[model samples]
Target chain A: MTEVTEPAIETVTIDVVLSALADPVRLTFVRALDAAGDWTCGSDVLRETGVTIGKSTLSHHIKVLRDAGLIRTRVDGIRRLVTLRYDEVEQRFPGLLAMLREHGPARARGISSPYTSG
Target chain B: MTEVTEPAIETVTIDVVLSALADPVRLTFVRALDAAGDWTCGSDVLRETGVTIGKSTLSHHIKVLRDAGLIRTRVDGIRRLVTLRYDEVEQRFPGLLAMLREHGPARARGISSPYTSG
Candidate 1:
């Protein structure tokens, strides 16, 4: 059996991560990942959101997030599976995710309807 | 006795906050505020960091962070005293601070040397 190659871990600054999250599209992507505790693909993410966006733009957003270390991807056959690196971000930023969760109007009250109402 | 005017509350999205934090200067500002635990003026902050910057640029950076609701200011005599509104951010973005703290490389280990070492 061939050995599976582990993806190289790249160091990203908090500023970069925050910058990646600055875009509305990226924020929505993060929220969706948080809501759905499973790996997702770019096409599926965009389709689920129903947001009209060009392929290049979507690709750009995903790339930004990936570079910031907020999301991790793995090759699954012919598909790329994406998941949030909550542990890594938590280890790097400390209190940032808690602040997001606290400030998240919908999730704060145990309600997950922020997207629909926000 | 006259009543001091309370600063108007402004609504800011997480994306805005993250955008403001994307800047290296702004991130330094936030980290300084976290370290100081008190209201600080723009001049003092700039001086403390010893980072050479023009007045206009510094003003612009401050405005960006203020617009994002990460910091609040009150006019104290002729000086503006600025403080981080951690509580407000916490209320709005639950789990964000915790995440930041957790991920903070230095702070996570119960150390306050992130600035010097990072």
Candidate 2:
């Protein structure tokens, strides 16, 4: 059994959380995790988000989020399940995740640019 | 008169805003600006936040925030006045600055760590 590590919710900083979520793919992952609970690595989550990236890249992004204390990863046999620390993060940063949940999908869709036509 | 550049509010992306605010000093700046409204660079805002950073470093952080579209800067005589684009940011990603305004001070005070004593 591989032991997964994560910081306590109170230990997380807004700075670290912001840094973790600064990437497009990771933001998409968090939005997905918020909408649909526990997600397995290399699952349909990526496909659902419409993001094209290598498996190693996705794993790296997950590692960053885990290190930032915004997520929990557990090993269920050979598969690793990822869960967003939504409530914990909300306790620490209040409305951060709610804002992400509301606006993140439009960002992930690359429609955040003002120059782009609707 | 030096020209100050910033992205239009609609051009701002949540990712850039998060990256801009990931730093402690920058976060403090935004929080202060949010609380006090228009602030002049090189003013007592730093003293208020209790952050000890140099002038050049502070300028760099301000530039990051400005480029990220989280702030608007205008040259007011010799002083560069900085203002949080509060409404614009709120329009782009609702609840983001409100979250920062609500919880940012605690994070700035270095009390975000669970290991720290209250």
Candidate 3:
């Protein structure tokens, strides 16, 4: 099992975090991760969020999220597990996750989502 | 007096807003505007926030913020008055301004601010 590395709570900056989440795909992914506990870099999340993208695109979004310290990804044998650093991010920048939960990407974009519309 | 123009609350997107505020300088400017209310596109805000930048750069940042719908800028005779779209942003994306208020750019960057230190 590989180690999970992310920015420390104290070292996390709002700018980096917001920049990471500025993408619509990443925002959808983060909100999905927030709603659900942990997800794998698989087609399940894609189907769940109704996001149509290739494997490379998903990988890029995952990398961006992890690099920004918003998500934690660790290799578990052959599978890569991903989880949102919800509490830690909230500690560093309060009200951020709560806002994401309350006002999701769908609402922000003025469009309904598969996750919310259902 | 020039008319104030901005993206309507319904048309405002989180990605644009986040992208605009992702810049450290712009984040500082928004926070300053939030705390101090209306400010001008002049030297006073530069002195208040301790951000040293040329007029063109400030104007550029102001344009980005305005284009992102995070702020409303209007011309009052010779002065270009700028104000944070605090309530409008809150209405569009709740908890964002509150988060900025609780975790300012200084705190987000893990630095002490002249405004807060004093």
Candidate closest to the true structure, highest lDDT: 3
The DockQ figures for the candidates are 0.41, 0.43, 0.50
Give TM per candidate: 0.70, 0.74, 0.77
What lDDT does candidate 2 reach at residue A86?
73
| Range of the 10 consecutive residues with the lowest summed lDDT in candidate 3 chain B | B109-118
Model 2 iRMS: 2.4
**Residue A35, model 2, lDDT:** 72
The TM-score of the first chain in every model comes to 0.73, 0.82, 0.80
lDDT of 2 by residue, A10-84 (tens): 777677788788777888788778877555554567766667999888888889999999889988787888988
TM-score of chain B of 3: 0.83
- Which model, 2 or 3, shows the larger DockQ? 3
lDDT of 3 by residue, B39-84 (tens): 5554567777778999999989988999998888777777788888
Quality class of the docking in candidate 3, CAPRI style: medium
TM-score of chain B of 1: 0.73
True contacts kept of 3: 0.54
Fold similarity of candidate 3's chain A to the true chain A, as a TM-score: 0.80
The digit string of per-residue lDDT tens for model 3 on A20-87 reads 88778888889888877665554567777778999898988888888788888878777787888877
Q: Residue B98 error for model 3, in Å?
A: 2.5
Model 2 lDDT on a 0 to 1 scale: 0.75
Candidate 1 local lDDT, B83-111, one digit each (tens): 87888776666655555454443223444
Ranking by TM-score: 3, 2, 1
Q: What are the lDDT scores of the predictions, listed in order? A: 0.67, 0.75, 0.76
